[model samples]
Target chain A: MEATTEARVPQKLTSKGRATRARILEHAAELIYTKGVHATNNEQLRRAAGVSGSQLNHYFPTKESLVLAVIEWQAERVLAFHRSERFAHFESLDSLREWAGFYIAYEHSYREGCTLGSLASEIIKTDLDVRADLANAFEQWKDLFRDGLERMQRLGRISAEADPARLAHLLLSAFQGGMLLAQVARDITPLEDALRAAIDHVQTFAVLPAADAPEDR
Target chain B: MEATTEARVPQKLTSKGRATRARILEHAAELIYTKGVHATNNEQLRRAAGVSGSQLNHYFPTKESLVLAVIEWQAERVLAFHRSERFAHFESLDSLREWAGFYIAYEHSYREGCTLGSLASEIIKTDLDVRADLANAFEQWKDLFRDGLERMQRLGRISAEADPARLAHLLLSAFQGGMLLAQVARDITPLEDALRAAIDHVQTFAVLPAADAPEDR
Candidate 1:
């Protein structure tokens, strides 16, 4: 069992120290993402990050800490992408569709799979701290979607009976599953199908006027 | 990179040899399921299976072969469970609901997560061969549901407009996603919510008589 050096992360550091720390984390994230956590070792981290033993120890006292940092780094990047203007505001069906489209296109272009999701799948079962951190990350991600769905419900775009929290969870689950299937199949069809189904399910809740309901169907 | 010794597997084996091989595969599967593939090495496998190095080598010439064998073993078990009497033969909405119930129960009882899905999520990005094996496993699993849904369509339980293949993919994706989230959260709510949403989506296609349609809603 690797120990976590939570105290090692200092409250203050020089600009150069911060840059070095960031470089190490970035390199470690790439290796861990590509080769998995167990297969990655300290020696490889040192070689990839071009950091000395003392420098690595100064930033992360243990392998577990390094992995945790990577998880945090990846989570921030994923959340930032979701929070971008194109994906953040989802009050309308058109915006939701656009978000779905952007997700599929990004997945197709970046075939490495979801960074936080891949990390969560690999380590969540074994490491307690990592699992907690991942759970928090997922909750934060779900909140972003939930907030948008709540707006939709308030504006009467969707039915009053729709549960935003559960819908957000369902959509995220489908996205995670779709990413896993796409990575295994090395094709975009599973993701496309999953998102399409999710979006269509959302559409079912659309509060259409009686005059337009028959023609819309 | 791990070298695969494909040519080492002999074309013929006696009954005793087959039993020994099965024992090795069973042990490897257990370890891989609990600890993951990279963490389970040859020595642990030998100790757990109570097999000598030569015997282990006789059965599986490479680590890769053992992992692949474990994958095939797990895939067969999963497919068999799905094909059992309780889960098989879905010709009506009631049968589909029963299948969904069986799945949720199984997931709750076995808290480790979906065997093939866990394996797929962990190794899909790193190993092409493993990814191929997992993709085939998921396709076989999906085919079972697709067949059942097709039967429902043929029997007029579901509308003809429902695409069984796509729906099967959608449901399986949700199941995989739900299992992952449930494992991470250490709760069954995610799995329950995901399956309920999927089952409800499927019910939307039910072919109801005009007289009973309004009341059913």
Candidate 2:
């Protein structure tokens, strides 16, 4: 996570300074999400955050730095949720289904699109440093799914024939793509269809019932 | 297709007029694909297309109109390829597999993200008119897959229980998402994994061997 955030604030920051920095980032993220990275300039962000120019500069030296920090901020928030108590382990297909359901049911998912996904669409055109940071965030996020799938494979819920890493990538891609379509349509049907298809694909490698497993019999 | 292109050129057009209009669209699409809708202005398009400002204006009265025209242009090009003799009918899982293989094997899929998809990411953020045009393009694209799946279902290759429309949307979502991930990673692995998962999911609805089809036996 530290490596992901090369745009870190000063180590000796006071509590008030930390609050101010966080405030700037919160507004910047909101602006970037609703508008876009390029459409959002320093002036609009300054007014939106209610911060002076120098203060904003003090926190984020350049526009690129500010963008990077926002990416880092969003990555932290999204990754934290995934790493939370309930979503941390995807032990079964049902668990993954629940996670997918969260995206469909969540208000922000409907209103805003996937937070990270929306940013990815805009930021992929930015410089290499920003893209690398965004890519790293995506890798870390994908790893969560991979870790869960690996657990399922080890438990024999998913067959060893299935590759967890590939499945994880599949799930994430479906999710990002689903979220984008849903956003475009302003309807959740696309997202629902995509997750169902992805989960169904994973189920293809599900071990057969006891009737087929003579050892169980 | 005309309905999709409410941004149509004038009813009366000399052949030269039509060619000049097309030149503007071709250059605009290229610039928009490489740069973006917001970043690629009329001036840049004028220079790229080797046309005068009034000429660019003659075809596209407004920037919004130009964007719609590009979306329509891209839609026609992409849909044409899908509707080509070889790809028009996805009669079997093998046909779909070959189509997916085409994406992976295609240089453009690796070099530039999806043609329509890149426009989609940016245009989705614009006004409803632009978004509507983009959405229509997507829906038309989705129908190509749906039509193929319907053919498969009618031929009894895919089971009757599967909804062709939903599966079509699923395939489109996977492709969109897979392409975006590949663009970010600059590798084709994510797209491959996503398409594979989607195709495997479609395979689940495949009718089993004659042992399960007693009538055939």
Candidate 3:
């Protein structure tokens, strides 16, 4: 009886409550994207989320907390997909081509600048914790790329010659740099070209069976 | 005798108490770069520039104004230098190579991030005037790149069939993305690789004057 009631009651949220929270985040992300973080406030959040003031505060006790939640949400949904099936078992040129295709499509949807990126740039002075979190996200992303590169190397798809760590670093850099430029320019040329070059370069050095160490002069 | 006063007097800045205002901007740029703009305040600005609080106000009525000054200064220096010199004549691979060399070496000194970028990120909810200026800078940069690409097409360095405007847009995106990643990750490997790849791509197309489109089937 207790289990039944508890399941129906929700550990803390009803289906309705979950939906409401999702709605709040959706609007909040939009506001944060358009307005500066400082300019966004709880009152605006309440109105935009269509919730009462008390509920808004209930879900998010503070603006910083709310922003942090949003950052985490984006990190999970937008950035973490790579760690899943998408980038998992990355070893072949086909996998890379598929990744590139997905990337191009995912990138086109990024009409607004990245919420985490926006916050990272804006909140550096106002909040050290937020800055650290954003910085940490990048580090993790680099790690993922490094892992992917290593997998590729082991599968005989990448050059054991070039350092996996270095390749990963380059790939991540080009990806982020291309996105930044695309955000401000409101064009995809920078993104497409940069990615095209990066993918082609990666393909060029795809591991050959006869790969050997550099010869001594 | 008159030279003594001329030397002692602060060099005439442009109106808006122009020269003194630029001094404020110069100091502000250095501060914003290292400290991150959010942490740097008006009093800090006054102290850093060796200007009295009143003098600081005399030049920049508010923090935002000082920020605007810095934006204008940085845009003019960084973008203009590239846009007018190597970038200005960017019709050939040779010019692209020279510019890339200068940019990467200069970027090594950047510990904080691009001043303009740091400001834009921080100014999320800043005054519309500031946003407008930031937007203008982005527009000017794209335009400059576009102009360079167009000249290349006209000179027959790049394929006449190539889209100069599109190429320029892509270059800007790649460049900015490189900078953003550098700031977040605190490394230059990605920037170095992206720039190198871009230069190589340009050279492959333009340096040889082979009279053929490299990417065409």
Candidate 4:
């Protein structure tokens, strides 16, 4: 049985070493997301990253460590997208709908879905520590949505009666669930429907005349 | 690559043979859910079912066949619960709430989750045929929710403007997403919040004063 332990990273690297590590992380994330952690062995990762066996071992001593690093890497990528300029605030109904569209509009490759979510489903089968890392990723992702919803509430776009925290969870779960169903069914309709449902749910709490009412302005 | 073909079951079985098959499937499902499909070997299954090696092969022939059988078995179990006396018809708001509560009420064991969902997550990594079967199971499950919503619509409890099929997908996705998050987090809060959000969405389209209206009767 694998121990429930946190991943350890080696600090202090040269610039070239840092680039090599980033390259390996990039390739490893793709391999793990595409073919699951158990299926993607160290040799396969070494070849994919164009790294030697020693280098692979130096960065990630075990497959479990690589999986953990990939989780962190993917989490950062997802959060970065949400924190990007267009989606940064997520303070308006328009942006929220656009966010939903962003997910649904993408044409997925075969066997492709949310990177972190796919990893979570596979990783949850094994260790609690890994699962906890994933759970934390989800919590961070949920917080982004919550921050936006709270912003909207303060601006009077969303009603004070609605709980942003609960609504944020609904949005995150909707995305996770939609991705799972969409991936399994090989159809994006489930994802579209799920995201639409969540957005519609959020709209129910929208204050009327959310238009250009310049009361505060 | 595994062939994208459907599973084939033997046409004939004696009473004892059927019982043995059922016993094997029951045990296989338990092992598969707990330890994942890729991790559970045939030897482990034979031991778990207390069957001889030949006996296992006589029933399943291949591991893929066993997995397909387990998917069907778990689907039947889920559908049966929804089709049972208390949940049969599922034609009211109160019953819908009960259904949501049903999932949240259960205390899942360590590494335990939705039987078919866990299977689907693992099975999707291998074969398209297996994924299609899991997709069909989800379709049937979604149909159950749609059936109830349609019934409520006919009874004037649900608004004519609402789409039962879409709403059903929402409900199913919420449950799926909720379970995925709950399993990873080892907490039912995400599931609880998701179901409540979905139910609230459904209520937005509900017909007010859906009480004992004698005119409809």
Candidate 5:
């Protein structure tokens, strides 16, 4: 069976096939977000993606590999969302409040709330590698907020002694807690109230040293 | 397999046997806190507790029930810890800072930290009953903090306009956030830094209103 080199060689896929693979990953993320990675399997993923059975098998030989792909996709999405200068654009706590309103509303309504957080929670029962991946993603997120807070402090928009890393951790935990409560209640009220109150505390209590902070970044 | 007249029913025997059960639960909590709930099992729990396999089974029946018992134990302990006057000693933010320090240090070193919270995070990935139990525990905790905050507000120690329940949510989330960060690092540094900043913010910025405002109780 291994005598012929050309027969054993893998063939490169067409553009459509590559697009189909990305579509499967996107759909897989949705399933993983809602149903959890362990609960979502190949058959469900195939049906959800509208791909044939053979196609899914062709791309990901195992569900774990597909889940890892979804995890990576979610990592990229969250990392990008945080780094899009949204945190930097805030003029003050008031502006942050406004941004928080938008954030809570959109997050609760769409985007599976938080795929990576859900993955982290889910994998605590199942996979070690996936848990590590999720943890790494969380660390990366904390770094983004830490960097933003440092810049704010240097510009006199925040106190020199302010701990950006801590605030970043606080922010991420608020979202996780809200998601947890929201999932339990099957209502958005907990998430909304939690977000509103959390942001208010951060705004009222976050240390801003300079009286004359710049409005434009 | 015939029963002896009245006593196939088993004797309510020695205090030593009862003591063994308590010891097992304590060690289960320890393992769950350090290695996580999913990673801890009956054989391991028995070995760590210095109890026999039969004794472990006599006490806990199943792994799920054992974890649930650990949770119930934690619920009682945490609630008792936060009882009014006990926790109310933390009246101002400065006191809150000291409290935060002691709290995190105790948490990291407290012979397996928080059993209920650890079990809850792991259980979120699984059964409905487990999720319901965790949700109930979280709500109960939030209520405990709310009551404490409300009492402080009633004593004119905090802002009358303060949302006691909301602040409770914020504080709990912040606590969880610190724990999670520390969990990943397998160290208490994140918990220390986060709680320090959070308590500092509360002290300096969360001032009370004039006595004329209505009590929120």
Candidate 6:
């Protein structure tokens, strides 16, 4: 839906106004998640968020702006959840495996796939304004993995030849692809296989020193 | 759109009618590729295919039916293209590398992401009927790679321990993920890195003879 010419985001809000804005965003996010961005209209948002037309307009001057905010929120939620569980501190190969296991389990339990990923998929072709936000979210997620791999390299757990940034992008790609396949097939096998293959590839770069090799008889 | 109660797919058609049906599907596929399924409506299809309302209804009683036919068409088109280029003959690691290189080049050339993949991502969450067709299409795509790997294993190019089915799934997942990221970023780097990593992982299972090992001084 197109915004009116007069539509504008409010310059500032009081504490109560901020609470209402958060409530509206939370509701809008759920609506957008359940119903796709194109399908979910402003009227639906107004009803779901229980905000007046003017109130909704004050926060999000356009539907695109609202969708962008939702993307950011979803990214923050995913990153915070992962960070809370030590997902960013991949000290060794074992930690990476543990993270993969947990990721698979989470996907199985929560069948809705990645929120940001689903949004990105739906709007990537049509919405130019949202692309930057979606790309930024993906980059942030990749950065977590890169930081962990870099730390592992510094500790000599990973070999020097492994490019942390490239490898991180590869892992993230496998993850997004695996989750999508798993969702569509209604099976976790694809996700498991993809993640395992990616992690095993990472293991190939483990710096096993000569001291760790067994002595010949 | 929901099918009308009176809507029904004609049980039989003449050769001329079949030709028109094929034309309709081709046009619809192109429209869906450009505008997405949800955005492309019956009116657009009628105009694009130059078919009367009765003719369109006679062929596809519902939009869902048209989408299903498009999915099948895309699957066949993709498989046929791959078959023409020896996609199902991974006789050696070099073949796999060649396939990956060709895949990256094709993605770069065609700015639009994978046709079936974009469709799957759009409809997977909401539509149940389309999900089965999408899943079948993906399986057929994966099968090409699986068959190739299986042939390699039988020919002793790959180790017995390497599971062709699993490895094929991994490669397919990576490809899907890479294509998506590349499409969003408008850069070929993600696709290149993901594909290279996947091919390298496949290489790890190569059955190397002892004679091929470099000799110590």
RMSD of each: 4.6, 2.6, 8.8, 4.5, 8.6, 5.1
Off by over 4 Å in 3: A1-27, A50-62, A83-110, A154-163, A206-217, B1-16, B34-67, B80-110, B124-174, B189-217
Q: What's candidate 3's DockQ score?
A: 0.29
- The docking quality of candidate 4, as DockQ, is 0.64
Model 5 / residue A85 / CA error / Å:
7.4
lDDT of 1: 0.78
Ranked candidates, highest TM-score first: 2, 4, 1, 6, 5, 3
Displacement of the residue A2 alpha carbon in candidate 5, Å: 36
Expressed as tens digits, the lDDT of each residue in A1-217 for candidate 2 is: 7554533678788999999999999999998888767678899989999999999999998988888888888999899888887764887888888888888887666456777778778667545367777777888888998999888888878798898888888888888888888777788888888888788888878886567787976
The segments of candidate 4 whose C-alpha lies over 4 angstroms from its true place after superposition are A1-8, A210-217, B1-8, B109-111, B210-217
Better of 4 and 5 by DockQ: 4
Score residue A176 of candidate 4 by CA lDDT: 80
Error of 5 at A211 (Å): 12
Best by TM-score: 2
TM-score of chain A of each: 0.87, 0.90, 0.76, 0.89, 0.78, 0.85
The pairs that clash in candidate 5 are: B93-B203
Candidate 3 Cα RMSD after full superposition onto the native fold (Å): 8.8
Shift of residue B171 alpha carbon in model 4, Å: 0.7
- TM-score for predicted model 5 compared with the true structure: 0.72
The Cα error of candidate 1 at residue A37, in Å, is: 2.3
Model 4 per-residue lDDT tens digits across residues B76-123: 788778888777577887888998888888886223778877677765
What would the per-residue lDDT of candidate 5 be over residues B64-135, giving only the tens digit for each residue?
777766776676666666654645645555455655666677746332334565456555555435555556
Worst lDDT 10-window in candidate 3 chain B = B1-10
Give candidate 1's TM-score. 0.89
Query: Residue B106: error of model 4 in Å?
Result: 0.4
Off by over 4 Å in 5: A1-17, A20-24, A41-67, A83-95, A106-113, A124-127, A130-132, A147-162, A184-190, A205-217, B1-24, B41-64, B84-89, B106-114, B185-189, B205-217
**Inter-residue clash pairs, candidate 1:** none
* B49 Cα displacement, candidate 1 (Å): 2.2
Of the two candidates 2 and 6, the one with more favorable lDDT, higher being better, is 2
